[model samples]
Target: MSRSSTGDRGQTEPLAALVAVSVMALGLALYGGYLSDVLPGNSDRHVEGATQDRVWNEIQTNGVFDESTDIETVLVAGSTGSNEATDLPEGYNVYVAVTRVGDDGRTEVVDSHYFASDSSPAGDTPSDGVPDAANNATRPVPVRESPGDVEGGRLVVSVWT
Candidate 1:
């Protein structure tokens, strides 16, 4: 009887240890997934959304589309290589276009600007068309033509890795 009791205790200890190890491993795996934002509702898309918000905020705060501001001049100069400096983030390709819907319901680009990064030739605006990046963020900026005349337009900022 004594020998049997001792043997049972030894087996129980090993079983308990095995269970503890498995639980610890599971906990570590969950933590790692959370850290990497692999869980539901926390993903790379969230980061991309945040990037879009940041770009929109920058455009609004800088008055990029306001006709009264010099941001258009700065962007145009940057795009033309006359001024290499730009307010856009590094490695980002920016396109700004102000379009108007005519009486015939046709949209026309009243004004436009483009900028490309030095390292990315593909970021350059296509000769006959717009930038051809699939992964891009766009924000509609309210264009104030005068003190009270506001129009609707979009500012697109595309980023590539």
Candidate 2:
């Protein structure tokens, strides 16, 4: 006398589960695109190829810290699409630190670190705060080589996305 069958109920449960899983997968994909800078207005703050090549060239050609006024510390900054973006993320992969260049033109990483956001002490921003340390208690990066025949005395910094 029953119009509904137990087999139909079992099939319905599996179908419902499958639909829920599919929806969850789609939501995760959308979120990943949004976070990976693939979505519209997403800021792709990656290291420029020219910048990296230039720094490497300087190190290879001029030789690391060959002069007395060689670069001591470098502060790498990262942000979302040049300041024209909205709701910038609170943290990025940019780093800040001091490095010592040897006569062989090799850069030796010394103190590498990043700064957290001003809002959350436990959070990080898309910018590097090494420059602020120049005026603060942070000590001037040790000058291993003096400026003698060096063309540019700026530090060589490399950033990764």
Candidate 3:
């Protein structure tokens, strides 16, 4: 017969392991919550609809697109990046992409591609054609596509998720 040194030593090992594991799991969860906002990655910058509206407002204030025109639209991008995260596929939606044509026969497009999931430590790019701080979430460059047979020109903004 084998003899044990401690009265409850046999049961103590499992209990200790359980407690250790529980603490580790809790710590990991808390870290994950913090990392979600602080992490530097594409998913971190996924913009939402309201932010898009704010960007639109900034555009209106900055005079990016001519609101004086009859047509004005704001593109709300759904995809964050190329991991298949959003409910909608990452592709261009013409309705959201805004374009304007002046009486002088000049065609202009204001591309608001990003629509950030969260507003963490943000960034801003400024230049003649660059988006202002308010519109920083959106991509800077504009991609133009012709709308065949459509009366007005088409503004296309490519998306990936």
Best by lDDT: 1
Tens digits of per-residue lDDT for model 3, 124-161? 21122323232223323222233222234333332222
Clashing residue pairs, backbone N/CA/C < 3 A, model 2: 64-105, 67-145, 67-146, 67-147, 68-145, 68-146, 68-147, 69-146, 69-147
lDDT score, candidate 1, position 146: 70
In model 1, how large is the Cα lDDT of residue 96? 44
Runs of candidate 1 with Cα error greater than 4 angstroms are 1-31, 34-64, 68-72, 75-82, 119-125
- TM-scores for all candidates: the values are 0.53, 0.31, 0.30
**Least accurate stretch of 10 residues (summed lDDT) in model 2?**
70-79
> Candidate 3: which pairs clash?
46-116, 46-117, 47-115, 47-116, 47-117, 48-115, 75-96, 81-161, 82-161
Per-residue CA lDDT of model 1 for 64-130, tens digit only, reads 4565444345443445464543445466554544555555778755555555553223323445455
User: Residue 79 of model 3: what lDDT?
Assistant: 32
Clashes of 1: 0
Listed per model in order, the count of residue pairs whose N, CA or C atoms clash below 3 Å is 0, 9, 9
Best candidate according to TM-score: 1
Task: List CA RMSD, all candidates.
Answer: 6.3, 13.1, 13.7
